[model samples]
Target: MPRIGVTGHVRLAEGTAELVYAELVATLTAHGDGALHGVTCLADGADQLFARAVAALGGTYEVILPATDYRTVVGDRKTFDDLLGKAVHVDYAPFATSEPAAYFAASELLLRRVDHLVAVWDGQPSDVVSSTANVVRTARDHGLPVTVIWPAGARRA
Candidate 1:
């Protein structure tokens, strides 16, 4: 199975973010067909969601951490174990630190390895930095398809 890269907004706090992530996990797992493609990525929001879901669904998963070392990146010992326990290694590279040009270059490398990009942007247009546009562009340049997921509109009561 081709790997699916997930990118999404990180504005959601503990409560709402957990619920949203749970749903996304379900969605991605349903989409994973196994054998043909296995899902994987960095261990963060959408990455965490997708990895956990894919593992539960019996699909192969890989972890792409943005730090030279897992312990350095994930201070939370438990979270680090959770992520490592489930994912396989695919090289380690820093993205936001003393270096930036290096980060973007590495981002391009990781993007090229995936088959599709699953973007989860918070529907707000004000977020210019981590906007879906950046992710979409990288994925397109790498010749991978994209699947975007935003918070579903508020439910009607």
Candidate 2:
């Protein structure tokens, strides 16, 4: 069974959550190559989506908090939510950093631990490296294969 890593925007519009969940579940299901043991993440966007899918698949879910201060970053609500009961571990990040730095560290750590990365990118091209293409690049640099999905109507720049 492979461990899947998920990363995406936390500010998706209404109704996008369910769609994202469905697409991720479908992708993991379609792989059909092995059972997925669990998912690791910070409990937002595609991370939360993957965790829900993992539980639905009768698998475990793990969370690697990007900071020791979960209340400040992702919120206590995200960690304490009823859906996360299946988590085996919600490891705090080893290094200390702020938001963006924490993301860089967490993303790298998540990439190292998981067998595959399912990037739920917005598919937009920006002046910054926040596009789906950037996600593909980072995953490749870390040597993790990436599977990307964007909702049908979300503009890709």
Candidate 3:
């Protein structure tokens, strides 16, 4: 099983989550070949969706938290707790707060550990240091295989 990681927008449109989740399952299924294992931060939107898809395939995943207080900042507290609880292993960045720097550190740690990256991005540019675009770019810069998934009608809210 490939150790897949994810980077994507944290705010998806109303129906975009479902579309993205379906595509993620397909992509992950193909890459996993049979058994599936993923690594994620369990943030809102794409991260949560990816975790759900992993579970649906009876796959296990590890959670890399940006900070110790990550749950306080995530959009969906319930979902975040649910996914975190399901994680086979959990690691935290060397930070006390969930700031951009902490997120960047977490993402970098995730990149170093995963064999491939799955980005649920819209191919946009962002100046934010911890944005999904930067993560995708960083993955590419490191010569990691990346699969960008943006289904039709997918939007960020």
Instruction: Summarize candidate 1's per-residue lDDT along 1-157 as a digit string, tens digits.
Output: 6576666553455555566566766666656555423344344455566666666666766655554544454335586577677666565555544133433444555676777777666544443433446666668766788776765652211
Q: Report the Cα lDDT for residue 42, model 1.
A: 47
Question: Model 3: residues >4 Å from true position, as ranges?
Answer: none
Count of steric clashes across candidates, in order: 7, 0, 0
lDDT winner between candidates 1 and 3: 3
- Evaluate candidate 2 by giving its C-alpha RMSD to the native, one decimal: 3.1
Ranking by TM-score: 3, 2, 1
Candidate ordering by lDDT (highest first) = 3, 2, 1
Greater lDDT among 2 and 3 belongs to 3
Candidate 2, residues 1-157, lDDT tens digits: the string is: 7787777766677778788888988888876564676656545666777788877877676877667665455544745565556688767667564465565566667777888888888765544343335555788887788888886754322
Q: What TM-score does each of the candidates earn?
A: 0.71, 0.81, 0.98
Question: lDDT of candidate 1 vs native?
Answer: 0.57
* Residue 79's lDDT in candidate 2: 52
Where is model 2 poorest over a 10-residue stretch in terms of lDDT?
124-133
Q: How well does candidate 2 match the true structure in TM-score terms?
A: 0.81
Alpha-carbon runs more than 4 Å astray in model 2: 75-80, 95-98, 125-135, 154-157
